[model samples]
Target: MAFVPAPGYDPAYDPPVPYITAIPGGLRPGMLFYIRGTLAKGYTRFRVDYATGQYEGSDIALHFNPRFDGRDRVIFNTFQNGAWGEEEKKKDTPFSSSRPFELVVQITQANYQITVDGKPYHEYSHHIPMDRVTWLNVKGDIVLQAASIIGCGVGSAGSKGGAVGIPGGLPPMVGPVCNRPAIPFTANIPGGMIPKRTLVVAGHISSGAKSFIINLKKYSSNDIPLHINSRMIKNVLIRNTFLNGVWGEEEKDIQNNPLQKGQFFDLSIRSGDQNFKVYVNGHCLFRFDNRIKNVQEIDTVEIQGDAELAYVFF
Candidate 1:
């Protein structure tokens, strides 16, 4: 089959492949569909499958597995108990870490072959019929260089018109909920609480000793602004070493000012995923992402001494 390069992808920078429509429907035994690519630190594999449509196997189609050997090769194999099943390895061939050039076979009968950097590296034996293997994929964060489906029936699996919906795609975490967009926090300053427009922190602020009492209120609600806070959150303490005492929409640079023993620092967070930075004693003490999003209310900013103020950029 001919392999067409995906649209919106830079073909020259990306590995090139023939369009999938040129290949014939049937082929002699021992044909292979080979893909070449580069791997990095992020997502690293791809899978193409016809099983989503009229195929007879599970929804999974074709897939690329990264080998976990000390070398950087990728693969998928059976695991026994809690460790790598030595006997389950496809071959005794040692894995390679040098930039790998690999190959895969889509056979009409028994196991298939996988070669890396042009060498016959591994073999896979499966019970599934090759006719049932219509889908294909190149998984992971590997940059696909080129691919060729040497056998037949290697075109796109029609469309996803009738596939059933799959759920539970997200993992666990108190991720920012889009529906509940607003989060409010209140600080109990030693003096009468003054409504400060912003609250900032440098690092882990110790509890008590003139700490900013930040509360996340109504954060669990769906009606709040997703960019701010979606719920009625309040009084969530944001500990810092230098906290500026100013508010408004203009961005102002904070002159490095000494922080008192009980005064927390003020951190300025820029829009997007910019780092939160604080200035203390004429020097930048710390900078990091607040990691929390959707903030609205700043009930108070308690300080042992006077707080330096500045406008917010975003």
Candidate 2:
């Protein structure tokens, strides 16, 4: 059966297999779909399809299939009028049985940019009109955890005129809702960090927790360009950079501490030309100056400590 679209951010957490839902606002440029799940043990194959409907023979705009039968590989194709189109295959597959995985599909004007974990994997050109796609179907040997459609900004999910800003002229881009992720979770920032790019981390702090760390690190390096350490016991939010094996002077000067034990919090960090603007629960928390001049190199995000992640979106 087709699921109804949800406004703003729509998410399904720990959904059953053969899951199908209507795409919120339909497909459009700059929107994205995030799926996180684990492959069952000894799994051979699984598929995710963007289709026109929820029926068994619905026309699939994009079929993403990963096969582990012999040599691990992924195949991309389309189905129209009960006929499968030419297949595009990639020999390497990033998914493994019994291992958790994160996948993001970004809708663009010409193609679908697929990212696995935190790296760009493939780009599949559009064979069917993206607007013709309305439902998302996932089936096969996988334990579906969380799936969400994001990047529509503050407007309603059915809005077609693009993201609309709030009354005060704030930016339109907003983070998607994510479910619980494994602790010590790390993912790559697609296209790397750049000005105007926003990262949202939402979760609940464990009761009687000590602290949690959120780091924006350089890919394949130990340098942490941005590190957020929230010490809940002390009520201090420490912001610092770790470069050359040394921690820079800590910036612990926030007027209020928004984090509380066993409470949910939404944290957003937006990159600027010279600083990172941080907001907590929709209020400006603090700003940290860019210590790493080359911001694009800071591509990995690491989160660990006493919290259950609701979602992480970049």
Candidate 3:
């Protein structure tokens, strides 16, 4: 799903090497993490583990080791009851000595979808309950650049990676914060929707909700490259684009019920070269062709209506 790191917990710049930070909440589906780093000279191996405790023998759920071990392979296994599980190794390696790389891992209910340098690489099924795994430990011969955790999924109590209250802890606000502000808010889409960067909107459908609108456009102009409106009354999700203040044709062939009243939904909009893909509840619901040619100009997002949004991160 398209997602932004939870507020406050997102790193502003490249973090220091050999870093340790609490997974703000814990692992859950729809959450994402990435490690940007370079292998050190004479690098033999590096390991990234998701564990219950920092101490040794603390029930590690996933032990990811990329090694040069002469044969050049990547091994994945579990450590339980103070013992290591049988290793599952694949020859496909995404790292090189003293070279920089980015690894993005997306957590789902059953598996972790890992991609290296924007390419599909591998999948690791969960050996332990993902939510029970807390700390993220990265060690071995590598230089860490940046790492982040984002919370935007169904029932994910992911590391808040930020300051203060949990993602869905607060009462769902219908209107404004404190008093004057509105719940339908807009925030900066950092780097302006770069490919591989996701846009996540999380919210609960209001009990008596009729509809809601999520628009992606430029602040300085009315050219909306993407306009997603969910009409619960009609049970359809409307997709459109506006050019020069003129609305284009509508798209609603997706027969799936994209939402349910009084329920929570995670909406992800992924940027592709030719289309803007939308997912509801982790299911692909719409794919709108790139009507706005230049996707980078889509800088502003606005959401307001019958749904109470938990957060929107891009």
Using TM-score as the yardstick, the better of models 2 and 3 is 2
Candidate whose TM-score is highest = 2
Q: Which stretches of candidate 3 lie over 4 Å from their true place?
A: 1-9, 152-163, 166-312
Q: What is the C-alpha RMSD of each candidate to the true structure, in Å?
A: 22.0, 10.3, 16.4
Sort every candidate by lDDT, greatest first.
2, 3, 1
Clashes of each: 75, 2, 9
Q: Summarize candidate 1's per-residue lDDT along 1-314 as a digit string, tens digits.
A: 11122111111214432222212232224555545454545433333332222323334323335554344444444322333322332334332334534444545455665555445666556534445444443444455544444323222232222221111221111111111112222233222111111122222123332322222222223211101110112222223222232221322123332233323333322212233333332235334343334233222322221222211111
lDDT of 2 by residue, 93-121 (tens): 99977457778898889999998876789
lDDT of each: 0.31, 0.77, 0.69
Candidate 2: pairs in clash: 118-188, 178-310
Ten-residue stretch with the least lDDT total in model 3: 171-180
Estimate the TM-score of every prediction.
Answer: 0.32, 0.56, 0.52
Residue-level lDDT of model 3, residues 1-314, one tens digit each, is 43333232333124555555566556877777667678987788988888887666788888888989789899999999888999888897978764567677778898988877657788999999876787788888877655756553323333343343424332111111111125577765655665434576655678899988888877778678899888989888888988897999998777676566775566777776689877765567777898766677777788877976644655
* Residue 17 CA displacement from its true place in model 2, Å: 1.0
